[model samples]
Target: MPLVAPVTVHKISGETLTEVPDLLAVEEPLEIRLGFGPITDRQQRSVSVTMRTPGHDEELAIGFLFSESIVQKPTDIISCRHCVQDSQKEGNVLRVELHPDVVMDWSRLERNTFTSSSCGLCGKTTIDAVMALTPGPLSADFSIEPAVLHALPERVRQTQRAFAYTGGIHAAALFDVDGKLLLVREDIGRHNALDKLIGAAFWQNWLPLSQFGVFLSGRIGVELVQKSWRAGVPMLAAVGAPSSLAVQMAKEAQMTLAGFVRDNRFNLYSEPDRVIIGQVMAFKA
Candidate 1:
């Protein structure tokens, strides 16, 4: 079966009602687990279960672990696989085996890692809770012209294969300064899409993505900004407006942030100096 599910929908326009077949982005829960041993004894524990699209389960799980600061490097993970523990499994549980030498911090695991469609460092008191996980500043050398920023939305739209089919998924793409699409991932959860992208990069030894910029098909949220910052991405552009917290993180991290990038127009929320306006032609939309 395709990752996207086809369903019948009733459309009501003016006074006429018609039933039509429509595609929906599939949503399912994936349980991420950790397994490790001390040469003689073995251990297994469940980390988190998040609602996400069906594909890229390993990438999603690894990305979640890295984003949440559970693990920093790709080598920290020994391997990943599907595990069935109970009747509810249905191939939805994933087990990530860490290097035996690595010590998993139970305290750092936090209270809970379960995330719904909308997830982040929740139940923690203040913004500082999120800021505590913030990564260091990114390199200031990599840059793109303001004109290129304006062209990104359309360029990214050209590669949204899943969104075209379902019209119900969010995409997160990585692009070079010249506006070339490096990678893109789509998911029902916007954050999950980004996680998959970052996790793929992590597995490919593509960390410290200092020269790359991220483009999101949805509004910029706090967790999205935090995740991008943690991954060392210097620039982030979103199709919709950014939340106040997202903007605040951008400023503190000194990362370039843009939003509402449509019709050749965009709003630079932070680190505006990073974009070189003189290099390309920029027209207001």
Candidate 2:
């Protein structure tokens, strides 16, 4: 399906109102189902239904599962494809078949009831519940220069095809230490965008993304930080501010967190050493 659709809107400026053609980002529901158990007795479960821009559906499903700790590695998945219902391809429904040997966790599927484009942890009972899933403090081995950090948002913006037309989509991108853009994903949801990026990296066996940093097109939420930390990303920077819990989570995980990363400046909330600055700066965290 197309990521954007055509629309007509009134252009109101001063006393003049003219109808002009415009584009809007497409938003649709994607149901992610999981197929697990032995070959003799297979079972399926509807895991998540999220509203997202219609593209890269498979990546989004895999990324969601991985970030939530449902599936560990790419090999754990036997196949991932859209489902066929009523003798027709159901574009909105996707199924991820897991390897038979992988033990299925029935409890994990309960927390994710329905995910929206704007929020990721809508169903979690507590912050500690999500915090327990972290793999521990990330490695402090990665580092990038301040100049390189300042240039990432624009670089991500340059490649955002959907955002260019609709101006309503969110994006997530991965970059190397020298400020090289490796991968980018766009969606109506900030969390889905990051999920797609992580899904792509996971397919390429790039977990434990210790040498790279993730950049977001929006605010850095605790969920986004958790997703990045799960992928082993050492640093995460966003164009907007980070919530208090997000900062605390990053500090606890020892991951670098930066916010307000635009117009040639950014604020480092934690693990400031990852961003190379000439002088020592004191931070309470």
Candidate 3:
């Protein structure tokens, strides 16, 4: 489906009002279903229904599963595709079939209720619940220069195709230590955009993304930190500020977190050693 839709709006500038054509980021519900269990006794269940921009649905589903700790590796998924039961639900439903040998964990599904595009951890019961699923502290073997971090926001902005048109979408981008953009994903939801980026990397067997950094188009939230940490991304920078809980979590995870990463300046919240200044160093990666 198209990521943006045409619309007409009345523009009011000063005393003049004029009708102009515009574009809006499309928001729609995507139901992600899981197919698991042994080959002889397969079972299916609806896990998540999220409102998101309609593009890269499969990546979003896989990324969501990975971020939730439901699926660990790319091989864990046997297949992922759109499977509509009713005609009314066409292009809105997706199914991910897991390998038969994978053990099922239904409790994880209970933690997530209905997810909105704006918030990812809406139904999460507590911080402890989220921490339980979080991975261990990242390795401090990687480092990047402040100049590389400053270049991320503008590079991400240039690649935001949907946002360029609608001016109403979030983005997540991956970059190497040298400031090279690897991948970018756009969505109506900030979390969803990160999920899609992670999902794409997961499909390419790029988990344990220790050598790369993830840059967000919005503020750093606890959930976003958790997701990036789960993906093994040691460094995260964003165009906006980091929440208190997000900074706390980043410290606990041993991850480098930078916020307000625009206009040649950024604030490091944790693992500041990874970002070197006034010195030249080599990264372990």
lDDT per residue (tens digit) for residues 97-182 in model 2: 99998886667655532233354553234345555666788875899889998888888899999999989999999999899999
The alpha-carbon lDDT assigned to residue 105 of candidate 1 equals 70
Task: Score residue 132 of candidate 2 by CA lDDT.
Answer: 67
| TM-score between model 3 and native | 0.91
Off by over 4 Å in 2: 86-89, 111-127, 280-285
List ranges where model 1 is wrong by over 4 Å. Answer: 86-88, 111-135, 279-285
User: How many angstroms is residue 105 displaced in model 1 relative to the true structure, after the best TM-score fit?
Assistant: 1.8
For all candidates in order, the CA lDDT equals 0.83, 0.87, 0.88
Which regions of candidate 3 are displaced past 4 Å? Answer: 112-128, 279-285
Candidate that scores best on lDDT: 3
- The positional error of residue 280 in candidate 3, measured at the CA in angstroms, is 15
Better of 1 and 2 by TM-score: 2
- Evaluate model 1: give its TM-score: 0.89
Record all residue pairs in model 2 with backbone atoms less than 3 Å apart, i.e. clashing: none
Query: What's the ranking of the predictions by lDDT, best on top?
Result: 3, 2, 1
